[model samples]
Target: MEIEAISRTYSPEMACVIFCCRVFIKTAAAEDLEQFVAYGDIDWNEVYRLAALHRVRPIVYRVLNNTNIPEPTLTRFRNYCRALSVFAFERQIESARIKQVLGQQGISVRMYKGLDFTKVVYGGDISLREFTDMDMMIAPGQLSAMVNVMKAEGYVCSQVEYLRRFPTNFVTNKKDICFYKRSPMGRLFGFEFHYRPTNFMMDQSPGFDELLGKDSSPFTHEQYYRLMVLNHGASDYYPNLRSLVDIVMLSQGRVVDVPPKLRRYERLGQELASRLLNSPAPAVPADKPLLKCATLITEWQLTATPRSGWEKMYMHIRFSSSFLHTLRLMLRAMHYFALPNEKDINNVQLPLFKLYYLAKPVRLLNIPSRLKKVFS
Candidate 1:
């Protein structure tokens, strides 16, 4: 409902106060409300109902323009968030210990996804980012041994069974080998053991090792930070304003002599921010959508680079126009029948290559019609 309509019932001054409170709580949690209110002259009673409503509200708008709330009220707003922070901190401490222990066993384990995310994004440890458990990335060959090591340290492998057609989900705990009833929520988070990140994509790219070979020095926390930010953008950045705020936090603290290794990462972050601004995706607020997206894009592009053929392909597909998305495979298919991608000494100019690529979807559309005539 419009603020004006709602204001008719309450005092205009009270309505204005409530509106300000809503804006504050938009980004600042209820625990932080007091500090935010200190800046304004509004009384607690004036905003109590508003804050109460905020606690119960569904956070309908995923994006917001600005937040003026104080930081103090954040803790009081929700226990779930506080629980999340405690869980993350404990998990990080545990994971770090596990890493050290596993290293001594001749089994090197690399931390992946969430733990790395907390490390890189907050600059040291963002225990406040509300992560559940820890996820470590180990080589597929090393998974059995790694699992055993974890099991000895109070973690039992989790087993939730779903049909094979569905994408895999796993959570291992200290009690059971697998718990179909328990989610990966707060217990033992998912550890997606992958030799390569590119394996999950539409096209196989060069593995993480290939990228590491080409100057993997700044490949610690900052690398993870860039990945999470980009992944969030791709996923439309679900349910959490704090996730986007984490991007803002990660972008800070580089005013002095910036490292050359992170230059590419910084550029990528900038590009993400710019592109998000340009598209103004569904989750972005209209007021600062472009600005936020552009900022994120710029920071990401600064750190990430295409390392393999698969990486290159992913980049091309992800950044390509819609037309490229539909026709890329078709062009590959037609290479067998038409012209070659190689540079011949004669340099034959066969325009059919372009024609075939362009007509891919149309050809797909005709298949049904052709079948109908045969059936008739």
Candidate 2:
């Protein structure tokens, strides 16, 4: 189904959240901050959700610092920033160690995202951005060797290929994905290694690995690279605000210059970020059905609670790539939610797992409510 946002779609609370979040990420100018905050009586809860969903908590914390925010809410913001600081520290160490190990074997690991780019954005303070895991891109030929090296280093590397999850040979980059941790039951990955960058479907990027031959070390000078990442995220409708912030900060910083050829793509990202800050309404993707639903659901979910079946289905449809994909994802999601990890192995075998398929219909019971919500 084609889902699009009609004019003036976002609620007032969401508008403020977007405005507040964008201005903070785009620029830290004193006057700009004052004007945005002056749009007073902020729904602090909505601000929290926007920050949390976009993974820009530290930046949001900075904006809310000298304001009249409530005690409990302020405490939550402080705690989140503190926790992210500790986590980013640990990831930074692991990323460094991984690069060291890989470098020993003649692989140059140039880290991006997470702590790597935080310095450019946060005035050299790596703690300002949360780093849940590291994203590494290496040569395609070294893929197996790198995995073997990581496994020998006491990291539990998952066997799943990034190809199954995302495109490896995208329009621009060649990338494969893998996750690693120190233990089998680790809750979070220590690293998320990619052989290449994520690709954008619309914009054509000169593949980073192609030009560098997997030998380049300095990402700070690669204008096309930064432009490509921004274009990739924007074209694909990435939900995270940090991505837009990445574009805004990269544009503001002197770290990289936009190459003449890639400036068009850079402008695409720059304009989108500007829209969030200046537009009268949200930057809802009317052309992209799935993206449209996601924006709506996010706005709705952030401002209100008590999700009815109708709302869930309305979101599930748009989130799915297609009708069949929805069924596939729904089944997968149901299976995941239905089982407890602590269940006895003997009691829950393959046959028992198959029983979870019954949940498909239960999840989709109100077909029309979802359809109605979308069409209306």
Please provide, for model 1 over 1-376, each residue's C-alpha lDDT reduced to its tens digit, 9 standing for 90 to 100: 2334434544433333334433433423443333433454544343333423322211211111134433333323344445556666766776687789989988876665565665565445444344544554455456556656656765543321111111122111111122111324545543444444432222333345533333424454445444444444332221123334444444444332223433333343434432322211224333243344344333332222214444333443443335665377445434423322222111333344354334444444676678889999
- Candidate 2 has an lDDT of 0.54
Which one is best on TM-score? Answer: 2
**Model 2 C-alpha lDDT per residue in residues 1-376, reported as the tens digit of each score:** 1011211354444554554565575443545455545654556777678677666778777766776667788899999888777677777777888899899988766776667667655677887765576777676666667767777887764343322222232212334445566534354656666554443122244555543345555445254345344434423433456665666565554545444444444444444554454312224333465446445634443343445544444444454545776676566445444432222222223334345345334443656578889999
Local distance difference test, each candidate: 0.40, 0.54
- Candidate 2, residue 161: how far the Cα is off, in Å: 8.2
Q: For model 2, how many clashes?
A: 0
TM-score of each: 0.44, 0.61
Candidate 2 structure, TM-score to reference: 0.61
Clashing pairs in 2: none
